[model samples]
Target: MRITALAAALVLVVASAAPASAAAADGTYEYKLLAKAKPDECFNGIGVPYPAGPPCAEGQPKVNQAYVWGLTRVGTDIWFGTGTNNNCLTTGATLGATKPVLNADYVCEYAESQMVKNDPKIPPEIGDVRPPEVWVYDSRSQRNTDLSAQIDKRSTDDKYRRDHTIGLRAAGNFKDVVLLAGPTAEGYVNVFAFDARSHRYLGSTTYTGYGNVRTFLQYDNALYLGVGVGVNGGDGGAVLRWTGSLKSPFSFDVVASLPVQAADLSAYDGRIAATSWPAEGSVNAPEKMAGVWISPLLADGLPGLTTEDAAGWKQVWNARQYEPDKVTAATYGMGGVASYGGYLWWGSMHVPMKATKVHQKVYPQDTDEAKQAQVKGTQRATSIFRGKNLGTPDQKIELVYGAVALPVYDGVTKTWSNKTTNYTPLFGKSGFDNPYNNYTWRMVVTDGKLFVGTMDWSYVVQDIVSGGSQVAAPDPVGYGGDLWMFTDPEQKATAVNTTGMGNYLNYGIRNMIVDGTGGLYLGMANPMNLRTDLTDDVPEGGWELIHLTKSCK
Candidate 1:
């Protein structure tokens, strides 16, 4: 569906304004629901008509979950990628011999059925792959185009094929070219580039060495890439510099090697700072742990952007300094990082069920009751932190949303050992005091204000294994993901919308970007595919795109 600017503005929802204060901005945010994933079109294969018949075989369940996986912007065109039935794919990827519980949420049919239908000889490591898509929405024309359709017809260039792409995880723009990338069935990262102005396919390439790619940072008028080189990003990480022409659109040169996977990157105080993911064996070593690291000063020359300055990076803070248990701390992955008000701000994240895995490994549980206890004991919320004068003797760091003491697990004693967090939050507890806010998904600083997007697990806490049992949970504080804003770090955060912008099923904000106008674009994540009864109160599952404009009083 296409919505004109005038029509979109007519349906805008003006959110409640913050409390009056000297530091507060006297205004409310007005948002418009621009688009939603079409249930019939999103899951259809390339060149296939809407409502494409039934599954290949009966009794074999169809993967139904769909959501926006990646998003970026060029000019007035918003480009995003989509994936379907991801929960099913994840189940197949994780469980080999172990069978998962029979849950309505997901079924690992990809390995047993879906793969053979596509290719019997495909590698098991990438057997769950599906055909993902790239789409571009022109803000000016208010028309959405599926770029994947054009690629599918390019029979001459096999590089443009989308048959094997599981999902596009990241989108970026460099030198007037828009790039979309995701993992393929061959266990490699495949990237496709298109002309930003013409919207024509340029080329595509697969990086076999990098198993995972996260974010793309544009700093000092140059583009830098962050990726993981080992299986599932468990070995090490590297930062790459783009050095390609139109002929070789996928060319990149290594800039730095990290002890583990690099997740996000930010520019601060004339240097680059990065957040990391723990390696397979780096949980106990402070120097090799997951934390914040800073690079040497990037001058106008090629020193910092080349391999010559790889050794000049320094680890300023680590997980060991925050959480007491090394294994649990390692399970706390790092999320969005950015520079705001002369300080570098970052936060920790809990990959769903990760802490439970760590707990079971540390203290071998023999029964279902013991396993449930481990899950309950390891449940944790994310914490936010900020630092100043990093890498200097006078450097200082403080918790922005953390506790003085947190529960920890001891492997040797096999008991819960609570430990001091070492610093108190300047604002309040982690997840803004809500334990279910597991991910600080994305953050952006605009107009002297910081906007934080979070993944709240409140809606599905009962459906998933997160609660550790089949017991009921209290009705959630509110359904959907949350959006919070901070006019000043010294003041409390104002809730922009805790009900996922009126859609109780929109679980999180996966991607957010400023429009360079007085507006922001949000890509929402909603994977509740089983709830297809639109006649009811619940909204249809999949993804939604919203445009929010700030209106001052």
Candidate 2:
């Protein structure tokens, strides 16, 4: 009788070993990888073939523009993660005309379908899911359906995210040590962990309601500290917490809250630091600015930055006030902060509030000197067709994003100072006049170096005066702000990296993510996802993904 009972117990144990559905296969990739989707053979996502009809017959080849919202390196495979940011392809400058620039940022959402699932609607409810998701490219199978249905599910977070910076720390080449995803528009951040050997999701934790995570950090182990976006724009929100017990599913708790509005958090040497938001209207509405805040790597009440405190704990430095005279805030939605060159940096992104683009832009007739002779022989006239830059550049005045480097030594005292300034312009905005004043939506700089990623393109800058040479309006004198990079220590950046990413629709500058390798992931509205231009496939609506190997290097 004892032997027979033991056999029964063994059977039950074997049955309970069923794999967890949320957890991928033993070798399934998690949040770190870039993989392309399968393409449809006959119906393409482009101008005509998709929703309305195939564009091939109309002389418009169906091409896809891809934009990447974020990147997750799961296993050895690198995934350019993103979702259909908007009906981007269809949202063209003109009502009916498609936006070529935005369209190139990514293949349409419909186009991504063939690559993942064959079912009509996916698990996440196509419209409900968020972009910037992790896809496993290494496990591609001819039967695209081989992947778990999670990729197809729609998102439940806020509609779209304006901030693209995600906090990431690495353990090794294939594993993403930690990924703290904080969307600017919402109050939730998804925590994901990768097991290098197993290549799957080991654990996940979700923290809800933190206003907007302006910035966060994955300190020590599972501990994540988030700051920014006060509650309903109130005084400020608390420094919450999320705990992962290492059990199958995880839970979170609020350890402690602070009175000050912290913007971003910096972690190093087992200690954590942060900056507070200035008065509201100060940058946009200074009356509401909160100032800077700091904390230890281990928050109050929490033992340490560990898997137990996934949500976070209380304040270590408490809240510190900022004096308007000593510090200034950046424009709303135009400011950013980064940790590089051994300090935390903050800056405001500036762009001319005025529209500098003319209805008719001057285009060189041809590269051949002979073909360009029309400029030398023909007498210039002021007619509309005469070809001239009509509008004056708001060059020096392009909107300015406030900036400051944390742990930076003040020039006079040579002490670590957290100063704020209005303007991402490193190459003296006062020096030149550019007809096409490029509005810098996003930028990064440190050690007297700079990198500017604009809504149009990217650029690296050097000497402010030398860089902004005399030139006609459209090609802004300051070498046009592409992805700007300033690696020098003596001054900020004024040049650009020569490499190119798709430019047509550069909206991702307002929404982007950076990886451990300093790769900047941008999302743009793309047309390549449309099956047809007329079928309402969102001819110009999609996303684009660009990989900048290194912003500082």
Per lDDT, the best of the predicted structures is 1
lDDT of 1 by residue, 99-177 (tens): 3233333333443444545576455443445577788999999888888877777664543447766788778887887
| TM-score for candidate 2, residues paired by index | 0.46
RMSD of each: 8.6, 21.1
Off by over 4 Å in 2: 1-67, 72-80, 86-133, 136-148, 151-216, 220-242, 245-265, 268-287, 290-293, 296-331, 341-343, 349-427, 430-454, 457-481, 498-504, 507-553
Instruction: Give TM per candidate.
Output: 0.85, 0.46
- Show where candidate 1 strays beyond 4 Å: 1-27, 40-51, 54-65, 90-110, 121-129, 156-161, 367-369, 465-477
Candidate models: Cα lDDT each? 0.69, 0.32
Model 2 per-residue lDDT tens digits across residues 260-279: 45554445334454444443
Q: After superposition, how far is residue 330 of candidate 2 from its true place, in Å?
A: 8.6
